[model samples]
Target: MNKAEIIVALDVPNAEAMEAKLQEMPDFIEWYKVGLEIFCAEGPAVLEPLKRRNKKIFLDLKLHDIPRTVGNAVKTAAAHGVNLMTVHAIGGRAMLEEAAKAAAKCENPPKLVAVTTLTSLSQEDFVDLGISRTVSEQAVELGRLCMASGIDGMVTSAHEAKALREAFPDALLVVPGIRMPEGDVGDQKRVASPSFAVEQGATHLVIGRPILQAEDPSAAATAMLNDMNK
Candidate 1:
């Protein structure tokens, strides 16, 4: 079985808050996801501390733009020495292809993954947006497009991990919206337990609030890793 990795989400407001969370986490916590909130607040300067500590980064900006613009952005992110980054699969084939090419050209490229669907949305949400397909169908469709466009992985809800795994066995399926069985779901609509996601072949599990909001963040992260291993 593949060893599932845990990426603690640093969803803080500023660099100070991010640094505090980092201090609370255990050494075994190898990867940290620097999402929109903190990244936008602190910019690339925030990542320097993580690099100094030798921790891996998952830069989840979910880049969505025109081909040339997205490609340039990828080059810039790669220069920051991130281990992984995300783009929107909904951006279509040409944009994904360009992002892939940009990464390939970089000397120390970040592995690119595409976001399928946000876990916050439901079928009703899709209908409101005039998206005709169901959530599962949309994830698969976009995932297929990503592979063909040469992107390496996908950021999807754990609910869709099994289907994506069966469809693309070797593809990196990074699952977010993971909550412990006794934990609150918060804003996520399709959350699942860590064990369930790992069983479904999720390679990396992105957990934010459960660990970040715990009374003891390190204990919370350790418990989450235990759940994944179980």
Candidate 2:
């Protein structure tokens, strides 16, 4: 059977821990997300094996910096053979445009995906950060800015997926912070089921923990794929 359009997060402490989970992953699970923790721990060298095995990579460093700095970072990420890399849309249009331009120069440029509001935040959380915009309004605004800046993909909460998809019809909305129905939410304040996101027009799903922490990782992944198929 075709696997679900899911990207499993390899959020372990180090390359060794990620390697252990790699062996347990179902064959149909071809894409992997190497986020800030593991990437910082092991560096791009850690993803070399995944590339050798031909697995697609989503390098989620959530780059947020000045235009020149973010641009330089994108060049390096693309050179590492990542299929997707993230920048924060909150960094504004100039930086987004610069990162896009940098990626355009790579021999095998990774798709530039800008991050909207993180899913771990709530309305209360926004107020704490001194922002008045509701989470949904902020996400949509950032997504619009990213699109207007020429980035085609965005990393956003599944809670915002339907509205984001509506606002940016052609975007590759990579919804993170996914949770199974009635599953433990961990630190994510905004979450959604895989089926609900699919129904709402999310182009991809970035799921961590739920599958990785399951007793039988392969079975958990397979079950998630089955769930997505429904």
lDDT values, one for every candidate? 0.94, 0.87
Compared with the true structure, what per-residue lDDT tens digits does model 2 show for residues 1-230? 12238999998999889989999998888889999898888888998979988999999899999999999999988888999989999999899999989998899988988888888889998888999988888988888899889897788887787788899878888888888897899998888888887877787889889989999989888877777779
Candidate 1: worst-modelled 10 consecutive residues by lDDT: 1-10
Estimate the TM-score of every prediction. 0.98, 0.96
The C-alpha RMSD in Å for every predicted model, in order, reads 0.8, 1.9
What shift in Å separates residue 68 of candidate 2 from its native position after superposition? 0.4
Best by lDDT: 1
Give the local distance difference test score of model 2.
Answer: 0.87
User: TM-score of the candidate numbered 1?
Assistant: 0.98
lDDT of 1 by residue, 1-230 (tens): 36889999999999999899999999999999999998989999999989999999999999999999999999999899999999999999999999999999999988999999999999999989999998999999999999999999899999999999999998999999999999999999999999999998899999999999999999999999889888
